[model samples]
Target: MTNYGDLVGGDRVHASLYADESVFADELDRIFTRGWVFVGHDSEVAEAGQWVTRRIGREPVIMTRDRDGSVHVLANRCSHRGTALCWEHRGRATSFQCNYHAWTFGLDGSLRAVPYPAGFEKDRVSLGLDRPAQVDSYRGFVFANLDGSAGPLAAHLGRGGVDMIDRLCDLSPTGTIHLAPNWIGHQVHSNWKMWPESDNDGYHLNWVHASMVSSAPDTYYQETVLGGETGNQSLAVDWGDGHVELDFRPSYRRELAWLGVTRERVASYCDALVAARGAEAANRSLWDGPPHGLIFPNLFLGELNLAIIEPTSASTMVHWHTAVQLDGVDEAFNRRILRQSEAAMGPAAFIVPDDAATAERMQLAVDGVQPGWASAADPRGWIDMSRGLGRERTEPDGRKAALISDETTNRGFWRQYRTVMSR
Candidate 1:
C-alpha cells in the first residue's frame, strides 16, 4: 500500500504517485467512487426522456431526466445481462432497451419490462439498476458519489467552489450558463491529476505556453498571467478544500479584457447583462470575467469552457470539454466564445496541446520512479511545489494567495489529494 502521507508533502510530492498503477486504482476507489465527481450538466437533459452516458471513475453510468423532470444517475449496464444500454454519447430515449436481452428500463432506471416476463423470476424492483447513493447539482453542474458515503454537495464544494461557479454563471444575462452539446475529448499520456494541477497552475504560462504568447502578444493572457512577479497583480489563490484559482481580476487593465476585445465588440451581450443584472453587477462581471479555476477531483472551470478529467489508467486520461454558451446572449457573442475555445483548447488547439505535451514528457520522465527515492538526501523522485510558499498569505476569509507565478495552486491540489487518499 502507498503511504499517501509520505508521498504527499507540504512543498513536494513523490513522482511515483503519477506513474503507479496501484495508486491509480486506489484513487478510483477512494476519490472517484467515495468522493464527489462531476458528471454532466442539467441543461443537457432539459426535458424528459433526454439522457447522456458518462463514467464515474471506471464505472460507466447514465445521466437522465425522467418523466417527472427528475435527474438520475445510474449504472449504464442492463440489469439482465450487464450489456451497455446506451451506446451513443447522448440521446433522447423514453426507455432504454437492452440490445442482447431486450430488457427495458425506464428513464428513472426502473426495470419496467423484460422479454418473456413470465420466465423472469427476479423482482423488478430488486433488479432495476445500480445507482450512486447521491446525485446533486448546483447551477446546472451535476455531480455524483458512486458509493454514497460522502457529505453534502454544499460541504464538498465549499465557498470557494461556489464562488467559481457563481462567477461563471453570473456572466450570463439570465444568471445561467448552457453547455454546448458537443464535448471534445483530448487523449493524453499522463495521469488525470496532471490536469487539475496544470489547468490551474499559474506558474507555467511564461514557459509552457511561450509560443502562444510570442504569436499573440496582445491576448488577454499577456496581462493576466504572462507578467513576472510585480509585473502583474494577478493572484494564485488556494481556496481550501482543494479548490484553486488563477485570479486575473486585479491584473485586467480594461473592462471586457477577458474577451480580448473592447465593449463595442460585444455591445449586445453587454446591453443584455446590464438590463438583466443592472449596470453595477454587469460592469463588474465584464471587468472581472469568468474564473480560471479547478474544483478539486475532476471539474475545470476553464473560463469560456468547462472540462472534466476522465482517468483511463495511470498514464492515460481524457480531458473532456465543452464550450460555455450564455443563456440570453446574442448568437454572435456565443459564437465568438466558441471560436476562442476552439483556438485555445480544441483537439488541435494551441494552448492545451502544449500543456499535454509537457505533462506527457513529465510522465515519461517519472515513469518508473520509486517513492523510496523521494528522500531528503537523494531527492531523485520528487516534484517541488514550494514557489512563494514562505510568502503566501491567508486572506480574511481563510484562503491563501500569492503572486500569479507561484506554485500555491499546485500545492493546494496535492494537499487535498493527500487528504482524500489518506481517508
Candidate 2:
C-alpha cells in the first residue's frame, strides 16, 4: 500500500504521484469511482429519450432522460455480452438495442426485450444495466458516484462548490446556462491531475503564457492575474473540499473586463441581463463575470468555457471543453463567446497548447520518479507548493487566500487530494 500521507505533505507532494500507474489506479477507485464526479449537464439531455455518453472512473455511463422526464446514469454496455451499447457521443433513443445480440433496454435502463426471449432464463430486472448508486445535480450539472458509499452529492460539493456553480449559473440572464453538445477534445501527454492544477493555478500565467501576454497586451488577464505579485488585487483562494479558484473579482478595473468588451459592444446581452436580474445584481454579475475555478477531481469552470478533465492513464489524458452559452443571450453575443472560446481553449488555441506543452514537459522530467526521493534531504523528487505559505491569510468564511502568484490554489487541491487518497 502507498503511504499517501508521506507522499503528500503540507507544502509539497511526491512527483511519483503523477507518474505511478498504481497510484492512478487507486485514484480511479477511491476518487473517481467511489466519489462524486461531474458527468454532464441536464440541458444536454433535456427531452425524454435523449442521452449522452460519458465515463465515470473508466466505467462508461449514459446520462439519459426517461419518458417521465427523470434523469438516469446507466452503464453503457450490453447486458448480455458486455459490448458497448452506445458508441456515439449523444443521440435520441426510446430504447438502446445491442447490435450483436439484439438485447433491448428502455431509456430508463430497464431490460425491455431480448432476442429469442424463450431461451433467456436470468431475471430481466437484474440484467438491465449497471448504474452508479448515486446520481444528483446542482443547477443542471449532473454528477454520479459509481459505488453508492460516497453519501450525498451535497456533502461532496460543500459550500464552496455550490457557490462556484451558483456564481457561474447566475451570470446567465435566465439564471441558467446552456452547454452545446459539441465538446472539443484535446489529447495531452500528461497526467489528468495536471489540468485541475494548471487550470486553477494563477502563478504560471506570466511564464507559461508569456507569449499570449506579449502578443495580446491588453487582454483582461492583465488586470485580473497577469502582473507581478503586487500588480493586481486578484487572489488565489482555496475553498476547501479540494475546490480552488483564482478569484478575479477585486481586480477588474471595469465592468465586462472579462469579455474584453464594453456595454455598447454587447448591448443586447446587457439589456437582457438587466431586465432579468435588475440593475444591482446585473451590475455585480457583469463586473465579476464567471468563476475561474476547479470543482474537485474533474470539472474546470474556465470562465466563459467549461472543461472536463478525462484521464485515460497515468501518463495520458484528454481535456474536453465547450463554450458556455447564456440561455437568454442574443445569437451575436453567444457567437462572440464561441469565438473567444476558440481562441482561448481550442486545441490549437493561443492558450491551451502552451499549458499542454508545459504539462508534457513536466511529465517527461518526472517520469519514473519514486516517492523515496521526496525526503527533506533530497529535493529532487518533490514538487514544492510553498510559495505563499507564510503570507497566506484565512478569510472570515474559512477560505485560505493569497496573492495571485501564490501557491494557495495548488495547496488547496493537494490538501483535499491527500485526505481522499489516504482514505
Per-residue lDDT for 1-423 in model 2, tens only? 888998988998889999999999999999998799999989999899888898887899999998888999999998889999999998999899999988999988899998888987889999989999999999999999999988898999998899889989888899998886599999999999999999998989989999999997988998888778799999999999999999999999999999999999998888888999899999999999999999988999999899999999999999999988889888888888898899899679999999999999999988889767766575568878899899999999998999989999999999999999988
Model 2: residues with Cα > 4 Å off, grouped in runs: 375-380
TM-score of each: 0.98, 0.98
lDDT of 1 by residue, 44-84 (tens): 99999989999999999999998888899999998877999
Task: TM-score for candidate 1, please give it.
Answer: 0.98
Q: Give lDDT: candidate 2, residue 203.
A: 89
Angstrom error of the Cα, residue 100, model 2: value is 1.1
Number of colliding residue pairs in model 1: 0
